[model samples]
Target: MPKIVDREERRREVVEAVFRVVARGGIQQATLQNVAAEAGLAVGSVRHYFESHPELLTAAAREMVHRVEARVRAQRERLGPDDDPHDVAEEIAGQFLPLDAARADETAVWLEFAVAARTDPALGPIAVELHDGLRTVAGRLLHRLGVDDPVATEHLAAVLDGLALNAALHPDRLRPDAVRAVLRRHLAQLPGGR
Candidate 1:
């Protein structure tokens, strides 16, 4: 029998190729040819999965968001019942930072997509969705800490974004240890922090 192809898995592979291209270079370099080469497939194969560049970009962005959310949820589930609320908040917020190699790659790709979304109409909505999702996470953390301020949630979201951007771009300067320390300190200073 002829080999069967997993279309959904193949599409995920193509999306991962796009992420590799963007993470290695930038969004500008994530062309169909480069992505195909990265995935060890022909350009025609890539086209078979995604008809156009915009569709591929959108898929890659969505995949990155999905990965980030999965990681965050997993981390949240690992928390102990007796863990301090502030510590829990810190751990949850740390999920957004580039503390490890996989997270660093995801952060790099996410930042590229967010920047490109500024002018790309197709990517703008994805970017907004990502922003809102992060803010909602921040709000939950704030509520857990007994704070109920929308502005505080927004500020925390911005802080997390800045920290992730800095850690992703300058890992040498802002090491994971430093990022954790900064995040712990920030969480400690929150209104209801212990």
Candidate 2:
């Protein structure tokens, strides 16, 4: 009898390998060979899961988006009726910041994918979909905090994006505490801020 392999699990392993490559050397370095080596598998095995580099990259990007969306939803669920609106806003926004090692890896890979999407037509749609989803979440956060102005929602999204990028790229300078402070300060300026 032959052993059975979990196809989805194998695919996830390959996708995670791509993330490791992207985190270390950007999307350009995340070749099938590199990913295979990272995943401790043969290039042929990697190809068995994904036919092409674009297919692998797209799968990795989709996984990243899925993980981030799940994290955001978890943060939203943590909100309580008695929680201060300002604190709630800061907590939700902080979900995107690189506050720890795992989050830093995810953010780094996401940043790489965003840049690669600019040139890779196949990745462009996934990148745009992630962006729009994030914007909608930000809009909802603003509305929950009583910020009714459309301009304010847009500005908040930009601020969150900038903060996440800076924190991911310069974790030493923009440490977790610093990232939290920046988000808290920004939330303090909102309409219902304390």
Q: Which segments of model 2 are wrong by more than 4 Å?
A: none
Which runs in model 1 stand beyond 4 Å of their true positions?
none
What lDDT tens digits, residue by residue, belong to model 2 across residues 1-194?
99898999999999989988999999889988899999999999999999999999999999988988888888878888788777777877777778888889988998998998899899999989878877887888888888888788888888888988998878888899988888888888887686
lDDT string, candidate 1, 23-87, tens digits: 99999999999999999999999999999999999999999889879978997899976889888
Q: What is the lDDT of candidate 2?
A: 0.87
Please give the distance, in angstroms, between residue 147's alpha carbon in candidate 1 and its true position after superposition.
0.5
Q: Looking at candidate 2, what is the lDDT of residue 74?
A: 85
C-alpha RMSD values across all candidates: 1.1, 1.2
User: Considering every candidate listed, which one attains the maximal TM-score?
Assistant: 1
Best by lDDT: 1
